[model samples]
Target: MTESVPPRSRPGPRRGLTERAILDAALRLVDAGGAEALSVRSVAAEMGVAPNALYTYFRTKADLVAALGDDLLGRLDLDAALGDADWRSAVVRLAADLRATLLAHPGVVPLLLHAGFAGPRALVAGEVLLELLSRGGLPADDTARASYLLQTYVLGTVALDAAELPPGAARPDDAARTAERRRALGGADPALLPRTAAAADVVAAYNGDAQFRWGLDRLLDGL
Candidate 1:
C-alpha cells in the first residue's frame, strides 16, 4: 500500500459498521502487508469505506492494532492446551499454541513487540498462564516470577524467529548470518577453538520446532 492511499468513501455512516467488521478488515491488511502497511486510510480502502467510518470502532491506527493483537490472542484455545494432565505438558501446549498463532500472523508480531497486547483478550491469556503456574506448586511469588519467565521466553523466541527468518524469503539473510557468526567466533579454529569449531555450524542454522521445543523444555526444567 502506498502512502497516498485514498479511502473508499461510502454514503452516510456506512450502515452495519460493526467493530468486528472493522477489526476483520484491519486484520486482512496486516496479514497481507504487515503492520507498516496498516493505516486508517489503508484499512478504509481495503474495506471500501470512508476513513471516518472506522473512527466509530477504532479511534486511531494504534487502537486498531491493539484490538487486532488482542483478537489474535483471544483465538488460542486455553482449555485444550491446559487439558494436558501434567503442568509441564500444559505449559508446553499453551506456549506451542501461542507460537503457532504468532507465526501464522507474522504481521501482528511487531504490534506485540512495541505496544504489547494489554487488552481484555491479553488478560485472559495471562490469567491462564498464572493459573497454570499456580497449579504447578509454585508459591505466590514464584508463580508470578514463573509467569514472567515463561511469557518472556515465548515472546522473545517468537520475536527473534520473525526477525531472523521473516516471511516469503528463501535462505533468509544466510550470508549476513554467516558473516555475523564468523565475526563472533573469529574463525573458530580447530587448533585453537576446537569446541567452538565443532558446533559453529549448529549455531548458524535456522531455528524450527525442534529448537523451539528444546529451549522451552530447558526453561521448564530449570523452573
Candidate 2:
C-alpha cells in the first residue's frame, strides 16, 4: 500500500519576516501616505502578506504606531551629531535635530507625542544630555526639569507643524475668528474676559513658531 503523505508544516520563525521588518514596512506606509492611511491591512498589503499577518507582530494599530515612533527615534543621533560642542550648543542642536526628524516623518509626530521615544538611540540621547547637564554644573533637579521642558517644546512645535486642515479652509481667518471666538466665549461681557477681549488680535498672534521660540526663550532664560 502507498504511504499517506504527511501535512506540510508552516515555516519556522527564522524563515519569516522579523518584527522589525514589519515595523519598518508600517513606518514606510505612514511616511508615504500619512497617518490616516496606515492600517494593518494596508501595511500587510504593502508587504505582500495577508492582512492578519501583521497582527502577530503588532497586536493593534496603536501598538504599531508606537513601535514606528520608537523606530524613528532610533534613527536619530543627537549626541553624536553634537560632537564636542558645549552644553548649551549641544542641547540646542539636539532640539533642532529632534524637530527635523519629526518634520521628516510628520505622520509619526502625533504618535511621538502620545508615546515618546523608546529605542536605544533615544536612551543614548537622554544619557548624553544628562551628562552634559552635569558637566555644565546643573543641579540634578534643574537638569531634569530642563530636559523635560526642552522635549516638551520640541514635541509641541512639531505637532503644530504636522497639522492638516480640510481643503479650502482658511486658517481660522485670524481677525474674524478671534472676534467670533471671543464673542462666543463671553459675548460682549468683557468683564468675563477683560484682558482677552481687549487683546483679541494678539490671541491669533500667540499661535505660531515665532511665539514658540519666544516662549521657549523665556523659559530657558528663567533657568
Candidate 3:
C-alpha cells in the first residue's frame, strides 16, 4: 500500500575507506607531489573514492595536514639515533636530523612553519629533550627555556635552508641589494657599488659551517 523502494536504493559500499588508509594515501601524495598538491579531491582521487568520503575521515584540510606533519616527524627515530650519546651530542644530532629531513621535503617546510610544533611527534620530541635536559642537571626553568631556544633555532635554520627564488624572480646578490638601496638613497653611483661588491665574498666566507659550529659550541657550553 506504500510506494515501493527500489532494490538499488541501498547503502553504498562501506568497505574501502578508513581513516588510516586516507591518511596514508595523503602522506604519499604529499611526498610525491609536495604539500601544495594535497587536497581533499586529489587525495580522494588517489584513493579512488568520492571527495566527500574524506570528510568522514578528516573533518577539514587542516586536520589532514596536521596528520601528515605528524606522520612525517614520526619517521625520525630520535631515541635509537641518540643511543647512549651524551645529552649535548644527542641534542646536536637531533638538530641535524631535523634539518636534514626538513630540507629534503622543502614543500612541507611551509606546513611546519604555519603549524609550528603541535603534533604528537612534536610533543614526543619535546618530552624526550626535556627528560634529557633534566637528567643532565638543568633546573626545570632553564631546561624549558633551553628547549624553546633549541626548537626556535632549528626551525629558523630549516626555514632559511628551504628558501627559494619565486617564479620569474631575479634575486639580487648581496651587493646588488645593498647597491640598489644605496642608490635609492642617493648615496653613490654604480662606480662606488663595484668597490663594495668585493666585500661580499668576505662576508659569505665568514658565514660558513665552521662559524656555525663555533657559535653552537660556545652557546651549548654556556648552557
Candidate 4:
C-alpha cells in the first residue's frame, strides 16, 4: 500500500492570494483593454489560477468591477480636516487629484461613467467633499448639490479628455495634441461661427489641468 502511492499532483494556484491581489490583477487587465477586457476567467488566467478561485474573493464579475471602482477612487489622498481658510485650496487639491487619477487610468473611466460612484471609498471621498463644502459656507442642501456637480464635472471632463486622446495608446502630448486640436478646429465655418473663429486660437488651447482648476474655482465661487 505504501509502494502503491502515486506521485503527488502539483498544488493549484490559489495560495498567497488576497482580494487586493485579485483586484490588482483585474486592474491590469482593465489597463490593457479598458473595462470591457475584464472577466472572471480573464482575471483568473491573469493570476494563473482557476476561474473558480476568483469566486472565493468576488462572487461575481460585477463585484470585481464595483470593487475596482472603489479602489480607484480610494486612491485620493485627503487630509482629515481642512482649516477654515484652506477650504479653497483643499477643494482645488481634491479636484485636481481626482482628475489626475482618472486621466492616469483612462481605461477605468468607463466604469465610473456607467456605475456613477459607490462603495466605501466613494463614501469616504464624499464625506471629505461635504466637509469642505460646508466649510466653504454652503448650506446643507446646496452642499449635497455641489458635491454631485463637482463629481459630474470631473467624470465628464475625464471622459471627454480620454475620448480626444490619440489612439496609439496612453499619456499626454500637450503641445503636439494642442497643435492637432487647432488643425481639427480650423475647418469651422467662420461665416456662421464668427465668434468661435475669432476665439479659435484660445479655444484650441485646451489645457486640461489649467482649465479644470479654473472651472473648479468658478464652481467654488458660485457655491
Candidate 5:
C-alpha cells in the first residue's frame, strides 16, 4: 500500500531581518571564508543591511561568534548518536561524532577552542559523556579525568586537522612525499639518532583515521 506524503507547509509571512537571519548569514560567510573573514561588517554586508543594523542582534563580534558556536553544537543529536550502544561504544561514537561535526565547519574549530565550551549545547554534550563514563563503572575521579582527556584529544585533533595552509599552497603527493621523507630520514647518521632512523619507515606512513583510533583505543584501555 502506498502511503500518502504530507502536504508541505505554506511559507510563513516574511519578517524583516532577524537574529536567525543574521546567524545564517554569518555562518555562510564563515563557510566561504575562514574564521578570520567573519566580522560584523562582513555579515551585515552579506545580509544587505548596514553594519550598525547587526548591533540589534549582536552587540559585538564576540557575541555573534558565541551564537554561531552554540548553533553548531546544538545541531548534534546526542541521543541518536549514542543509540543502544554500550558505554564504551557510546563514548567512542560520541568522540567520533564530535570530530565529524567540527570537521564539517573547519572555520569554527578555532572558535571552539578560543571561546571555550561554555555553551548550553557543549554543557549537555559534556554531561552525556560523563554519564556514559560513569555507567562504564569508572570511579568519579576517573570519569572526570577521562572526560577531559577525551575532549582534549578530540579538540586538538580537529584543530590541527583544520589548520589552514598559506594562500596558493599546493599539497605534495602523499606517496611520493612520504617515500622521499622516509628516505631522507633513513639516510641520517645511525650513530647520532639510531632510534629515529630505525623508526623512519613506520613513521612515514601517516593515516589520520588509523592514528586517531589507535590513540582512542589506548585511552580507553587505560580507563
Candidate 6:
C-alpha cells in the first residue's frame, strides 16, 4: 500500500490574534455575561480560538482586566473636555462623562476598582484632571488632593450605582421596593430623627443624576 501523506495543520492564532481583537472579545463576553465571565478560555472561546491563543496577547487574567479597563478609559472624550473650557466646567464635563461611561459598562466597575487606574489612557485622563485643577490656580498639594477626591468620588459613586440591585429582580418590582423603603424611612420616628423626618420628601426623592450633580458641584466649590 502507498504511504498516506500527512495533511497540513491549521495556523495558530499567534499569527492572526491581536490585543485589540482580544480586548474586543473580552468586552463582548462582559456584555453578555458580566466581567466575572471573562477569562482566557472564555475570551478564546468567544473568538473561536484555543485558550492558549490569548497568551499571545495577555499573559494573565489580571492583564486582560487591565487592558479592558484601559480600553474603556480610552473611550472617554477627555481631550474634547479639556479644550476651550474653564477648569470647573472641564472637571464637571469629565466627571459626568466618566460616570456615563461607567454606567454603560457597569460590569467593568469592579475591574476598574481593582486595577486602580493604571495604564496609558487612565494616566492621560489623570493628567488632564490635574491640569484643570492647576490651571484653576490650585497649589500643588491642593491639586493632588483634589484629583484624589475627584477620582474617589467618581469611582465610588459608580460602584454604589452598580451594586444597587440584586440579580434577577424586575425593574418595576425593584422600583416599588425602593419606593416602599423610602416611605418607611420617611415615616421613621420624628422624635428620634427630627431632621430626617422633616426632610422626608427630599430624602425620598433621591434622583441619582441630581444627587451626583449636587455632590460634584459641592466638591468643586470646596476646591
TM-score of every prediction relative to native? 0.80, 0.67, 0.69, 0.86, 0.76, 0.82
Clash pairs (backbone) in predicted model 3: none
- Model 1, 23: alpha-carbon shift in Å? 2.4
Question: 86-150 in candidate 4: lDDT tens per residue?
Answer: 88788888888888887887777876687767889889999999999888788999999999999
- Local lDDT at 110 for model 4: 74
Off by over 4 Å in 6: 1-16, 166-194, 205-207
lDDT of 6 by residue, 147-220 (tens): 99999998888888766543322123335645766878966899999998887766654536667898999999
Sort by TM-score, top down from the best: 4, 6, 1, 5, 3, 2
Off by over 4 Å in 2: 1-10, 13-21, 164-217
TM-score of 5: 0.76
Error of 3 at 132 (Å): 1.8
Least well predicted 10-residue stretch by lDDT in candidate 1:
165-174
Candidate 1's displacement at residue 206, Å, is 5.1
What tens-digit string does per-residue lDDT give for candidate 3 at 1-223? 9999867764544587877798878766766766577788999999998887777667777888887677767777777645745888777767667766766666677766886667888789888878777767899999999888877777776565455523223333445644555444454333777655545544343323444456567667878
Error of 5 at 39 (Å): 1.3
- RMSD in Å for model 1: 8.4
Question: Which candidate model has the greater TM-score, 1 or 6?
Answer: 6
The residue ranges of model 3 lying beyond 4 angstroms of the native Cα positions read 1-35, 165-215
lDDT of 2 by residue, 48-154 (tens): 88776676678787778777776777666764645755766666666767777767677767666776777566777777777766666879998888787778888
Name the weakest run of 10 consecutive residues (lDDT summed) in model 5. Answer: 164-173
lDDT of 2: 0.69
Positional deviation of residue 64's Cα in model 6 after best superposition, in angstroms: 0.7
For all candidates in order, the CA lDDT equals: 0.78, 0.69, 0.69, 0.80, 0.77, 0.80
Once superposed on the true structure, which residue ranges of model 4 sit more than 4 Å away at CA? 1-13, 80-85, 165-168
Candidate 5 clash figure, as a count: 0
TM-score head-to-head 3 vs 6, winner = 6
TM-score: which is higher, 4 or 5? 4
